[model samples]
Target: MKKNYGYARVSSKEQNLDRQIEALTNYGINERDIITDKQSGKDFNRTGYVTLKNQLLRSGDTLVIKELDRLGRNMDMIKKEWQELQENRINIIVLDTPLLNTEGKSDLEKKLISNIVFELLSYMAEKERIKIKERQAEGIKKAKEKGKHLGRPKAKYPKLWEMYYFQWKSGQITAKECMEQLDLKRTTFYKLAKDYESKLIK
Candidate 1:
């Protein structure tokens, strides 16, 4: 027989899962068949989600969530996981988004519905990311206008860095010579060189 499983998530341990669990149960999912995770929606590393996806769910199993965010808040990651689950032939149903439910849908219907939802979701998520970046930039501008120091202080260059840096860049001196002069390891010398070169390019 095909099985149905419920996955519920709360962003933090202090938050209640009562609401999500209640909805899942009312949808006729067995209490024992529901897995709950008390963790951030930032990633899919939660114990419950991992176990539910890897261990419990099987081909033809239907996974239900109260909301799409319960799958994850990061849309990019959510879309990846969604694709994986579909590939594995597991059905998905979001209680709040009935259009995504695939339990009894034909294969063609499932593909069409998921594709449309994914595209719409990606568009919205990209817009949200842009808005967030714009808000952050505005905040930074205000802070700069107020003359507040932001970000880390620039890392000071080591002694005798300038002369050796030029020599290394011009290939007049080997990298080993530059590292030995600056008392830097090969990795550190190359990283500093890259950072310096990037600044020069800018």
Candidate 2:
């Protein structure tokens, strides 16, 4: 018998899987057949997804997902996986995009149309990602122009920084001892020392 399976994913452990689970269940997939992963969709190497693709799913089986992004965030990877599934003769049903469903697409013309649509969607997705990154870069540039600090705030210098720095510079204290006194790592201590010296020079 042809089995129906559902796959769902969340980007992080903090996100709940309840909505995906409910959607799959409502679509008539058995709760047991609904596989889920609490990990980013950046790749298809997710534990749940890998297990389902390699072991559970078979030819003639139907695989349902809430959306294309649920499968993966990488457009190229998503296209590759989709082609592999097609070669395996697995029917894919994307609930959010009905046109992507391949259940009733048996004719040559229909298949051609589906392929064209899939390629267009994949291209659009990739383009959208690029646009988002461009927007973020522009925003950062604007923020910098306005003198707004970017990235994590610099750590404050330790209370005994002046004393420890002078001792370290004068060779009276070892670098290790200075770091221990400031309760800082080697990198942080050196960074602070460099910044302090730069300020003194000014």
Candidate 3:
């Protein structure tokens, strides 16, 4: 008998896998036959999906997915994976769009339709990624313009700045001595001192 397997994925940890499970169950796939990944669908590095592919796949096997996007966000990677499964004689069943079944079509028709869907998905995923990058860049630019510090928590020692200035002016005291007096590590001492120096220059 041919083994039937189901795959489900979510983009984030905050999303629940229950809905997908329920959908798969309603579709007549058993609980044990469905492998779920509660992780971003960006890559095929999913352990659950990999394990399912390895153990459940054989010639004439059927693999079901909730949707094409759930397989991967990258269109090229998804196409490559789909081809690999087909080469192994595994049929793909996409439940959301029942007509997308690779087994239900001729080889040429399957390639053409799958290619169109792949292009559309890849474009969408790439667009989303670009938008995110642009938003992040705009936020960072605005923060810089407003003089907001970019990263790391600000130093806790206001007094250290004053002590550093005084000790530095006393030519005899070294930076190490000033740091010791301020009870700060080299990094913290230097960071505050640099910020203070920048203020003086302004």
Candidate 4:
């Protein structure tokens, strides 16, 4: 008996995989037959996905995915994996776009349509990724031009820092105690305090 397997992936743990799993279940696939990866699609080194590839797949089994790009970030790798699954007699059904399924259609028209959709979606995904990177770069450039710090916001310690400095100088409070009272983390407190000391000496 052939089994239907579903694959769902998200780039990070913060992303919810429930919707994808729900869709698969609604499509009649069993929860036991679904394999999920909570890792980046940028690479094929995902733990759950690797296990599914090595052990779960068999000839005549159908593999389901929400989208083609969910399989991998690299276009060439995505194409290769799609071909590999097909060559193994495992059909692919993209839930969002059923026309990409290779189980039934084989005519010239069908093939042509499939190719067009694949190329279009693949190009769109890659373009969107690039656009996000460009936007981030532009945002950073604008922030720098406006004299904004690029990383974490600087700590504001108006009275507490002054008190810390005074107590530390008088030997009444240790540096650790000053840090504890300031409620700033060790690294941040040390960095700010060190910079202040350096400037005072100069």
Index of the highest-lDDT prediction = 1
Clashing pairs counted in every model: 0, 0, 0, 0
Model 2: per-residue Cα lDDT over 136-196, one tens digit each: 9999999999998899888799897898899999999999998998899988888888899
Residues 1-202, model 1: lDDT tens digits: 8899999998888999999999999999999999998886445469989999999999999999998877776787688888899999999999998988888899999999889879878898999999999999999999999998899764557988999999887999998988888899987788788888898999
Error of 2 at 119 (Å): 2.6
Question: What TM-score does model 4 achieve against the real structure?
Answer: 0.59
Best by TM-score: 1
Model 1 whole-model lDDT (C-alpha atoms): 0.88
Q: Candidate 1 clashing pairs?
A: none
Residues 52-150 of candidate 4 have per-residue lDDT tens digits of 777988987888888877777667667767766765777778889877876555556445645765687688878989999999999999998999998
- Cα error, residue 57 of model 3, in Å, equals 3.9
Inter-residue clash pairs, candidate 2: none
Off by over 4 Å in 3: 1-52, 70-80, 134-148, 156-164
Instruction: Give stretches of model 2 more than 4 Å off.
Output: 41-44, 107-110, 133-137, 144-202
Which runs in model 4 stand beyond 4 Å of their true positions? 40-44, 107-114, 129-202
Question: For model 2, how big is the CA root-mean-square deviation?
Answer: 6.2
lDDT of 3: 0.79
Instruction: Rank by lDDT, highest first.
Output: 1, 2, 4, 3
